[model samples]
Target: MTYPPPGSGYPGPQGPYPPAPPPAPPGPGYGSPHGGGKTNGLAIAAFVTGLLGCFGVVGIILGAISLGQIGRTGDRGRGFAVAGIILSCLWIAAGITIGVIAANSDSSGGSGAAPSATRTKPKEVDAQKMKVGDCINDNTTASAPSTAEPVEVESVKIVPCTSPHDGEVMAVFRLSGLTMPPESQLRQRASDGCKIRTRSRISRDPAANSLANSYYYPTDESWRSGDRSVTCVAVAANEGTKLTRPLAR
Candidate 1:
């Protein structure tokens, strides 16, 4: 090979490499790698809320916003955003299915009308408000024979005459008293008044033989509270028996 002078600039075998092309200006959008960037804040929030299932719609909105941001800014968490959206959709679908099933179950349960139509139970009424011909039942002892002890009751349930019942009101009478009568005298007065009032009615009913007269009288407290009315009821004569037909009919 020929040699040039010591101070002269000379080309090498490759003739001095190209200038390096200004380092190629770095490729477009060439920052950190896709998953190496900062994590997307909305993506984290969406994932946490979606796992709870209570904020499904909110999670979906946040996930969509995160996905858009991730595409534009090349941030991390793309998989988290997509998973959040999918989980949110699944939770919403499950909630809708449960609601539909509950609605259908309720609709099916109340479809029948026969049970409510022929119901024997009726509204309750105050015992003091019992009127003649009102068929009634109470929570006291089942039987109310003529000789049975007095029952302390606040209310009674009025039922149909055809339904089985404990008692049926035959008459109502009032006792005149300026003060509470003695217990014995009170019972006597109530018993006398009820018997006198129900005597004629009992004679007319052919089924009266199966019935017995019972009376409701006011207590000392009730008498002080301005209650002076007494009610006469015809009940089954036998203990533990329920009257099936109206005594007056």
Candidate 2:
């Protein structure tokens, strides 16, 4: 074997063989930088897949994570993340809009409120607003209505009493007969049922053997409704008055 000397164009087998030409360009350092682009593409694909599916919300979350990773590593998932976020927001907005629309549609079933232990009462019912000769009846102890009777003259009012007991005072009258003042100005002294003879005189009569007084309530509606009268006693101005009358049948 002939050994070549240094500077003779022949390796002397003493140093590192000229570094081996950098190992053939390192076979494309980093396995083809194209891999980074692929990572970003995969991220975008995943985001789209998630958005189109029912898992849009999940997609958004995953996309966000991928985007974060891309920012940190220069990876390929950024597109996916952005798409997911947009779709997720749209879904959320749709749900909210639907809720608002349903609420305002005026459906009886749509009414809602947290259940409260407190009982709510019905509002006041004004029977007086009935037609001139119409009688109104309530569902509770209040008497059924009778037809109203508009008398020939408007001067007379039939102020009637019911059971001769004042509904308001919670007390019964000792005697019967009109409790009104001599002058007919204040036609009805006691208002048991609030019925009035718009054009008739009011008279009270004690029950034939019962401690009850009957006040006559005359109205044109009562007469028309085939009801001649209502018996009610005067009501006191001050009594823990009923907040409202029960609903009428």
Candidate 3:
């Protein structure tokens, strides 16, 4: 049998549906009752900057947090969150492109050139092993079998000379690998494929092989070894020119 119902186990039909459970306490950062829910100023700034990519990924983080909080308070600013995502994507794209270009420009010159940089050799100095800041005082030309027919390269040698046309200064870097240049990088400022190119020559030293037998300078192409690519400048070794010494590497 049911007991009398005043404050019994079962409530009467009325009682306003148990007076609705007490509202949940405000979240951690919401503070005391006197203080109301407030958003962080830095978070707002980050969200805005992130959309511009100025904040990069940092902005994305801030915007995400702010966006999440908005759900709890029904706030606005979808623009800021979207902006942060856009910025992060842009930063990633730019960074990736830069990294790839640098890698391509640095393909290697596989041999022992980089390691033997300290060794001294007989006859002509191995100039290719020189360092960035180091300067050579001698201009001893090295010789190899002429790769071109008719021994067009005589014996693959070089001397010193200055530019008559006085071309502008261009790129610079250390020498490595076989020192053989890429076919594309060099051009005879005067002739087709230039009969003979010099690094920066005005004339040839009879001492270091003749123009007919010398290696062309101002190499039109870049060369690769184990893992390094060397750049060269173009200088023709035709007549009306001379070779100087202590060539700059």
Error of 2 at 177 (Å): 27
TM-score of every candidate? 0.51, 0.34, 0.31
lDDT (Cα, 0-100) at 45 in candidate 2: 59
- For candidate 3, the lDDT comes to 0.40
Question: Among these predicted structures, which one has the highest lDDT?
Answer: 1
| Per-residue error (Å), model 2, residue 166 | 31
Scored by TM-score, the top model is: 1
Q: Write the per-residue lDDT of candidate 1 for residues 7-117, one digit (tens) a residue.
A: 776787678676554556755665777435799999988888788889859989999999999999989988888888888999999999999988886666555533444
lDDT, candidate 2, at 169: 15
lDDT of 3 by residue, 19-71 (tens): 66899998776444334556445456666675566555787677677777665
Model 2, 1-249: lDDT tens digits are: 976776677546676566445455434446333564456654675567566756646766777777777777777656567876777778767878888888775443444653232323222333332222222223333331222221222222211122122221112222234332332322244343333421121223121122222233434443445433333422223332221221111
| Whole-model lDDT per candidate | 0.83, 0.40, 0.40
